[model samples]
Target: MTKKICWAAAIYPILGLLGGLYYRELTKAEHFAGDTQLSIVHTRLLALGTLVFLIVLVLDKVFTLSATRSFAPFFWVYHAGMLVHGTLTVLGRESGAAIAGIRKPADAKA
Candidate 1:
């Protein structure tokens, strides 16, 4: 189904982002601290993310479908969303402190 394929292509990035966050945390922990391994995760995420992007792009043509006006294509909406989310996930998991800096100010501080 064209719609299903579209949905899948779109979902991949979101999942990838979650995966990034998990990867980030896993790599940043004291027990798992290792640039080599961290790099590997980063590389994998980018590779997979890019693949997902390509899939969404190409699948549109291959499947001969269009997203509903009400539900815009995931590829378009999630392009940056997924990239940022995934990157942040990886970074946060690996370096929570870095992510903490980006979060909203603590209530006490605010």
Candidate 2:
């Protein structure tokens, strides 16, 4: 169970890295207007996802939380919430851009 928690915690940094790369690409694009929503996605994925996961791992070690069944549910729900939040944020940004007649670079392919 501890190993499972560690593996789950490790996934966040990789996801955050992917988010950072996407944000970096957007920043480098000439026509991509800087959007706070994208930045929020990057920040929350790193800060809330990666950083908080590590913190939780440390707390679990100190408190011996892996022995408890509640930890599994709590862990899954917390990560799910982060995923949902990030997805909704990106969708909201795209929706807002669409409403304002701003075309996302990715939408150009369609």
Candidate 3:
């Protein structure tokens, strides 16, 4: 799979889950589920995360950027590359925690 898709597969679910949890926390909708309205801020944050990830995916293919290699000759590009990498890492972690919530139950025996 392309890097962007691979990365998004890993990232989007996490964003979804975090968005869910953050929604839950901010709204405390559990006690009264239908009473709480969805927060626009939460939606915006997740969208921003997705947008940043897409940018990273595009850069991965379009540029000669490396996550590790420093390019003092092209300081701006290097800095931008690093920022994208960092954003992806954070999104991936958030996604992971979110995924944990949706996993099937584990059983040792029938």
Best by lDDT: 2
Q: Name the lDDT of candidate 2.
A: 0.61
Candidate with top TM-score is: 2
Tens digits of per-residue lDDT for model 2 on 1-110?
Answer: 76766776677777777877875675555345534345555567667777777777888889988778797787776644434433444544433443333434544665
Instruction: For candidate 3, write residues 1-110 as lDDT tens digits.
Output: 24534466366557556755765664453443332223333453356456655665566567744353563243233223323332333333222333333333232243
User: Tens digit of lDDT per residue, candidate 1, span 1-110?
Assistant: 45655565566666656666766665566345433333334444456655765575575677644554633555355334434444544444432443334544233365
Ten residues in sequence with the least summed lDDT for candidate 2 = 94-103
Measured by TM-score, how close is model 3 to the native structure? 0.35
Per-model TM-score versus the true fold: 0.35, 0.51, 0.35
RMSD per model, one decimal: 10.0, 9.0, 14.7
Candidate 1: stretches off by over 4 Å: 35-110
Question: What number of clashing residue pairs does each candidate have, in the order they appear?
Answer: 7, 0, 1
